[model samples]
Target chain A: MMSMHTKNINTHLVEIKDYFKVAISVDCVIFGFNDDELKVLLIESDLKEFKGKWSLLGDIVRPDEELDEAAYRVLKERTGLDDVYMEQVQTFGAIHRHPAGRVITVAYYSLVNIEHVELKLHNNELHWHSVKDLHEMAFDHKQILDTCHERLKQQVLVQPIGFNLLPRKFSLRELQNLYEAILDMELDRRNFRKKFLSMDLLMDLNEEEEDVPHRPAKLYKFNFDKYDQRKKRYLGIGF
Target chain B: MMSMHTKNINTHLVEIKDYFKVAISVDCVIFGFNDDELKVLLIESDLKEFKGKWSLLGDIVRPDEELDEAAYRVLKERTGLDDVYMEQVQTFGAIHRHPAGRVITVAYYSLVNIEHVELKLHNNELHWHSVKDLHEMAFDHKQILDTCHERLKQQVLVQPIGFNLLPRKFSLRELQNLYEAILDMELDRRNFRKKFLSMDLLMDLNEEEEDVPHRPAKLYKFNFDKYDQRKKRYLGIGF
Candidate 1:
């Protein structure tokens, strides 16, 4: 549904950028789940303004760019990944949070299946740090990460977004672990099993994990079609 | 405390605006509660671009002006009301949500103590419309208002923000009614009483209603001090 209005927006922004010297920016908190832990992607800063400090993936917004495009550009430039599950979480404007002087950062968070996409850090040195194991970050990045983490936790309970952070074929145990990690609470195995199965959003693949130490658990894929059909009837409002 | 950073931001924006033709704007969904129903302030569009259609209380953003200041300015200009308790809920940027091209609107929702704030509309065509009774609005304001309504409901439960929408000293019944109106659900009075009192954020003022046809109810004022202390502990993270 690309409306004619969207074209007008592109042209308008081009004109606005030419006139205004305002430096809009985008910051992304890329989330990846692995082995019952929720991790966020961080980059080592190069700018002398934030030298030697780890920061959320961010950069100045291009003058003639859409907000979402700027966010995606930042992600691609830093992570070498595209078409990942991304959503705008919030915008931070504390006036002086940025040392570059009055730069407003629109924060976007993404849920990427770490197994499918290869992590190519390009020019920036990037690493995945466990949310629990985060140290002091550059600028107001600690606060930005906290906000994105909370949004991710809130979203997990209401939507099937967690699937985006896991492999296409995942075990039931893996799914349970993802929820427990994000919510920061232990779930009763039996109750969790009953609840998720009742939703009928998981399809049995009749396959088992390969190259495991012990007996491998059966694999399953998210039944996106079923979830879509039941979403209207689903009352997944809050925890 | 206004930081030196804010002062720098003010100055930087001034220099940038001299070059850019960008304008700042504020759109307010001034919510009011009366006759046990939730209402929002709206205005008839003056521009030939949106002739005769209803719109939100919005105007252009000023150069070097704080976002909150711009919101309050629009409220005072359109409704002749000042000192309103407004919160920046979210920013909407869908490329074409505005017909005037890519004008990204940062939405601010104000909870006017419908009793304390005067409905002195500066624009003769401005009026308060019940949220449920609203038809098609100019631009994507209907969508923006819906998002604000959700934010208002969520904030009302977790924080004692409802106090800003109601009279300073109000009865428990009135408070409960406000909750029911915003949440759009019938909460048990006993449960509601238990939940709110347990929070320990409201102080009994030991007063009664002035005009009523039924048994007068006792009045209470929100304990802002305790609420502030509780916020330090609670951090507004409620389900």
Candidate 2:
């Protein structure tokens, strides 16, 4: 019975069993855009201790799941959408971060186009909360949200990941609004348009906004292929 | 027998115990500068299966320790130094990454001034390997190393963390050499010096290199306070 493979298995069993007291979980700060405001999906906590408090949609990761898979699964199960862009932001492992003994959670922020996906809130508790209006949340989830939001703000300027929050065909005005909502700062309109156009990563689709009170702007789609190639060249150089 | 606190504890215990099969660890990619080359501290694997292969300096995170605390402990235990500039780069949690079990590791890279620390290797197996010369590493360490290296390269251009790898007072030439080594490309000396000086983050010590084969270059030190304030202003804006 003590073959090479068997020996390896035994060594793993003994070493792993002793360290199994620590549990791993994943928390997702899923950002969605609706009506020119940045929103995050949250659920009212079912735990009695956190009754009526909002919390990031999360679950204890199963033994068989990859960290990213667990996060994507949480997103899919909550929103009924797949193929959303998600990035792991950070791992939070304060010793008492969890009320349930020694649970460490990895935080991921995902961007989904709100108008594109039909959410299937399984418990009917999930709702999109405006990022600016968020109050205290359950179990250090507020800290997690802040961290992911900071990351999102940082990433939007450099990477084209912000496109995930917008519809496929979006006007320049809508793009500027998205940035303003995420950054919480007003950007010079002319400067913003000039900067983005100079990057050469947007395609003029010859389309205009469907409905608007004022003059509708020309529509453009992110040229992902060009962005991908340009991004590779910009790596290691900041901005 | 169960008060409110005890009842909460019991609930946590039951929920957490079911997910205890996952083990967590912290891996430190300790980057150090040696002889104008960017180097990483690695140790020879103790496992018989990986004999002679280099591994990141790491250990299983103890149940009582925070994730960051565990990374710092590994760095201190391995290098015999504290207060080094450390940052968590990313977490790797691929299933089967560890042959022993499903071990998820958070990777951190610490910049240590090699000349400042008296490294007590504990065993002769520990060595500083030039990053460019590293071959296959034990476990998934090569990928981990690459990821951390990429993060370090990206960070040096935007932040003052690279100062942690150099002496307190260094000539512009030394600083450029450090950048060239980390970036693996030759930078124009005059251009590099001009760019850094333009930031106004460096303070001229009015000192020269003490021992040099050629004429000693004028020395300067990074102005930490100015860099800290400047960094906040630069946030959300790409380099």
Candidate 3:
């Protein structure tokens, strides 16, 4: 049996309005990769407090929607794409973080192939800014972006999340480039290629680079779909 | 310049009342170790909706306090201890998850030594329930408990968080037993000893077991205070 150390709530009909309620929102850190740079999708804020500063795509959470659903809705409304890979990173709640009021937002980071986005169909105010170049941001967006970037950097080392930010068919050079961009470091090319080859996570596409200034490199596709199907058969035993 | 894809928010003073807002609270799963079983501190729910159900110790977060301060306040109120090790695992915001009207509570788990709790000073309603035998709980607390337990398990593998749950001086056998309890698996004695010894995380206190039925094992204390002090000197260089 459990016991408590606090007073009971007086749930009166009129007292409901007297209770302290807060407005919750969800922020999406949409990350993409292109031209050897990692980028995040951002929009201009209309709020007068942070004029001219870019803000992450976000909106107030409706009472009927789940937190994850609210995040997905924000993503779809901005990107016009479904079936995105998203992870909820953390929740930001500070009394004065929002100038409008005490609005706490759950932050989520998503990885998407840059080519999948059709810019013409999206709003003109939306733009993809290089993650390395962002300095000033509306609200605490820069902190949120940095938190998600650290998570992505750690995940890429142990998981295959980097594939989501790349083309279906890519060369070993391209994959290494993606890693370098995410980590912001120059990894030893020989050791990196050898490590990937030993893991056997890629399929030989039997294709070559279409055009290049130097000799064209061979291309291969991530061999995950088949492995993922096999893993789907594995069961997680609970305690 | 940043752009918007959705209509601007109409922040009318009267419209503010019409905006959807939810009450936010914090629930703490206080974990204590004693009698070779993992236990969680729970309180009896006086609410008629969940009669006889055990609930986690929690309270509605204040408007002025940060989310972390609310959790620490709960821990201090219940166990009469400060500076506890607590981590916020995730926030649960499913519709109707709380029987109360639209309350989304952030769940945090705290590790405490059982001896640290002076039950006399605390309310009589508080009791420690064995985590392994718990099946039903008030609200969605069972889900919250499992989530925090999963986080604790993962943290033990890479971090020294488990030291918070054990006594200051312990034998190697006692240390292994604590690890086994948290992980719920048997580790080879030889390998476990070798692994911990290689890390040099424990200080040889030059002590011996005093009261024991059989031969006594060497007693050692976690050498973390020194290591932690050294780590504090190191800085995190950001990109």
Q: Give the candidate number with the greatest TM-score.
A: 2
**DockQ (Cα-based) per candidate?**
0.11, 0.31, 0.27
Candidate 3 collision pairs: A2-B43, A2-B44, A3-B43, A3-B44, A3-B125, A125-B3
lDDT of 2: 0.80
Best by lDDT: 2
**lDDT by residue for model 2 (A74-126), tens:** 78876778798999989998988776678788999999999876766445267
Better of 1 and 3 by lDDT: 3
Q: Flag regions of model 1 displaced more than 4 Å.
A: A1-21, A59-64, A76-83, A99-101, A185-191, A194-200, A204-207, A231-239, B1-24, B59-86, B94-102, B153-164, B168-239
Off by over 4 Å in 2: A1-17, A234-239, B1-16, B234-239
Is model 1 an incorrect, acceptable, medium or high docking prediction? incorrect
lDDT tens digits, residues B118-152, model 1? Answer: 65543426677888888787777888899999888
Worst 10 residues of 3 chain A by lDDT: A230-239
TM-score of 1: 0.73
Q: On residues B1-239, what C-alpha lDDT tens digit does candidate 3 reach at each position?
A: 23333643311112344444687778899998887778899887766777778888877777898989988887887688878898887888888876667777788999999988865324426799988889998888899898888778766765678878888888888878877777777778897888788767789888888989879888888877666665432111111
How many residue-pair clashes does candidate 3 contain?
Answer: 6
Candidate 3 iRMSD, 1 decimal:
7.7
Per residue, candidate 1 scores C-alpha lDDT tens digits across A136-192 of: 877889998999998887778657888999999988888889988887878778877
Which of the two, 2 or 3, has more DockQ? 2
User: What fraction of correct interface contacts does each candidate retain?
Assistant: 0.07, 0.42, 0.23
TM-score of 2: 0.91
